[model samples]
Target: MPLSEYEQRVLEQMERQLSSDDPKLVNTFQGRASSGLRRWVLVGLGAVVGLTVLVVGAATSNPIVGVLGFIVMFVSAVLAFSPPRRSGPTGVVGPDGTVRRPGTAPKPSRNQSFVQRMEARWERRRDERGR
Candidate 1:
């Protein structure tokens, strides 16, 4: 079923708020897959170079060259498989364009175990939902 008018308005409002909050996140979600493809292309080139060096080293009698080639291959493989890191702060932006840092939740007591903290959080969520 289609959303009612009120629901549509709420969704539009949310979208506006989200765009205002962290535009980079919105852009990331909207971005094309070209960047990932470009990274893979670079990785492929590196791997090919590394493989060539490895072959050349093998043909010659250089152990150091072979080790260097292996290291290059390992680094290329890691870059190919690792996820890209995002730079910059993603803090909330106010209407006047001032960036407001997000507030962190209070940490649980130091004495509490991980499981106990998780359970307490779960209970709080459940209680909130009940109301």
Candidate 2:
């Protein structure tokens, strides 16, 4: 269902407030960069493994193994060079804590229990003291 105009306005206001209140949180809504970097690193590792296998097969004079090694290395190199999928901007947390795109409503803060509220308040107090 589409949001009513009032609902959209309220949501926009909340988003503005949230963003202004916690600038660091905006990026977190999408996610950290480590996950993407890890994937590329894995591809590089596979290439290294394939290269090692090729070297070993050549040294052992195993024609079949050498051919397999060559194929693997070629595939690994291609994968390592492939461009990563472009992820959306970070800090757009979805209902499940995963980041969503900007302009999407975050899951309602209604899920915050008393303890969570208390912790938030306490953190705010601590921050005020630091300031």
Candidate 3:
């Protein structure tokens, strides 16, 4: 069923408020970082691997093999410390609270508090059926 004019206006106002409050929330939401202990442990492991590779490569007789080993070790170290990429909605949320993906219409603002919407729906249905 179509929304009444009042419902539509209320939704629009809620959308406007949410957009003004949090613009960053419109962008991709990044998850929290890993725990400090886990992060440090990974860093230590990377360091150890890097050092071992460097030492073994340097001790080797062949210069070419040593260079290759160094490159591999360097790449591994870089990958280990690299930050993870954000993986949430990259779309901007319009006036609505919904995240608007590219090429899609702005989502309808269903921003009424849950209780409010439910109560309104119940009232509307009751009135429609002459209850």
Candidate 1 residue 67 Cα shift, in angstroms, is: 1.3
Clashes of each: 0, 10, 0
Q: lDDT per residue, candidate 1, 37-120, as tens digits? A: 888999998998888888788889798888788888989999988997644566766445666666544556799999999998
lDDT of 1 at 120: 85
Give TM-scores for every candidate, taking all chains together and pairing residue i with residue i.
Answer: 0.51, 0.43, 0.35
Worst 10 residues of 3 by lDDT: 26-35
lDDT of 3 by residue, 18-112 (tens): 76787566332434445545666776676666666667767876666566656766765776678755466568775436676765754333887
Candidate 3, backbone clash total: 0
Q: What is the C-alpha lDDT of each candidate?
A: 0.81, 0.77, 0.67
Error of 2 at 75 (Å): 1.9
Off by over 4 Å in 1: 1-9, 12-32, 88-131
Off by over 4 Å in 2: 1-31, 86-131
Q: lDDT of model 3 at residue 22?
A: 79
